[model samples]
Target: MHLTVLSRSPAIYTTRRLVEAARERGHRPRVVDPLEVELGLGERPALYHRHRRFPRTDVVVPRIGLSVTQYGLAVVNQFELLGVPSINGAKGIAASRNKMRCLQTLARKGVQVPNTVMASDASKLRQLVKHVGGVPVLVKLLSSSDKGGVMICETLESLEAALEAILGLGQNILVQQYLRGQDLRALVVGGRVVAAMRRRARVGRFARSLAQGAKFERAGLAPAQERAALETARIVGLDVCAVDLLDADGAPLVFEVNSSPGIRDAEEVCGVDVAAEVIAWAEARFEAPPRARATAARRVPREA
Candidate 1:
């Protein structure tokens, strides 16, 4: 089968492994920057290639990252319009990107979530904070989060300062009670947590995200943690996701979910083959819609 990876770069761990695995499975794997392609109003979205007609693709695996959400989802949506089967579609990406939507979805499913408030403007900030006990809180962007633009304010005064900075960035933020506990990231592939790890901030670090100088270790899970991760993905409408859970005062609170989750670090830390599991899922999903796939011999020539 011919599989196309709509990603911004080949250097990303998940993108490279999945593409290479597809090749090993006797399938044609092509990686392209979705930004390079323009969607045209036609039966097929014409890809602007250097030479020759672009090879027809079977499936699209979108490795969405901070830099690629704009052109990336547009490209993925075109494929869906053409009736292409993706493990996780553009709608799923959109749903997972919005932090509030995912949190609400999980909460509606009876998943424990940190108390949250969405303020359209700064006017409701003070009232919202009071309802949550006037304690320190965490404010995060609705989309594009990976420890990049999240703030933890330890006091109302600090919260106000943080809120001003966030709103100044021209993006709305979700204010939630900060769950004081260890952070764990559970990677769900094919509706299961294939890999999970406890991330800890090294001395003097704040956020437990690897980007924030956090270290990871294989975390032992209770049956409850396993159940929570799986359910979190289900309610969020994703075949693959990363569920961020925090234990707050002995109760686990679901904090975040990522449709396009990265597992290279978790896989290494947990001694698990999450990439292989992703390959298996793609193999199974692709099998059901064989007619939609390009055959092996339809490979893109290396020098054509």
Candidate 2:
């Protein structure tokens, strides 16, 4: 099978690993920059990179970055229009990128998530804070990523200041009840939990994201935690994702579904060939063809 990876940088660890894994599995793989691709129109819609048109490939795996999400998803949508299936797809990526939408979808599916509230009116900021369980809450901007969007407010005064600062920038915000528990990231690939890890925040930090100097180690998820993680992924419509869960008072709650999760650290800690697993799944999916959407009730977990 001819596999193409949509990435800005082919030399990145994740991209390199995926290319290597595809080769190891006897599949031809190449990296294409979405920004460099041209989208063509008319009866025969086509995508071209440089001066050459995209060739027929079994599947496309988009390792899109948050910075280029809009254009990246546009490219992915073009591939779908040409009947080429993407590993994560455009809809899934869009859904996962919006923090509020992702959490709302999970909540609607009866999946437990952190108590969160989004409000546009500054007058309602206090009410929103109260609704999310008062001060010491989290005020996160929907547009930021890699822990840059999140803020921890310890008092009412601090919360008001944070809200003003965020709203002043013309960004939407979500207030969430702070969870003091384990920050576990469950890597779901091909509808299965391939690897899970716990992120321990550095001193004086609340956000335990990997980018925030968080220490990580391979961790095991409980039955409930595993179920929540997998279900969250399904609801978000991602074939591959990392579900962030906070163990709130012993109950696993969805933090966010990350469509393009960084796999380097997880790969090293879990001793799992995550990239290889992704390629194996893509190979099978290319042959079998994917359903329009995954059934929310069905258990899609496979042996890892």
Top-scoring candidate (TM-score) = 2
Error of 1 at 121 (Å): 3.7
Relative to the unseen true structure, what is the Cα RMSD of model 2? 6.8
Q: Provide the overall lDDT of each model, using Cα atoms, as 2-decimal numbers.
A: 0.70, 0.79
Clash count for each candidate, listed in order shown: 0, 0
lDDT of 1 by residue, 206-284 (tens): 3222345557788876678778888878877778888888766556788878778787887789888776777778777
Query: For each candidate, what TM-score against the reference?
Result: 0.82, 0.85
Q: Report the Cα lDDT for residue 38, model 1.
A: 62
Question: Candidate 1: which stretches are off by over 4 Å?
Answer: 43-52, 122-130, 133-136, 143-147, 154-164, 202-210, 289-304
- Expressed as tens digits, the lDDT of each residue in 1-304 for candidate 2 is 7788999999999999999999999988989888988888886676677757565566889999988899999999987876676899999999999888888888989999887888766557788988977766667777675467777665666666675666666667788776533778999998899999987654432322234556789999999999999898888999999998888877988977888888998899999999999998897777652442222101111112
Candidate 1 residue pairs in backbone clash: none
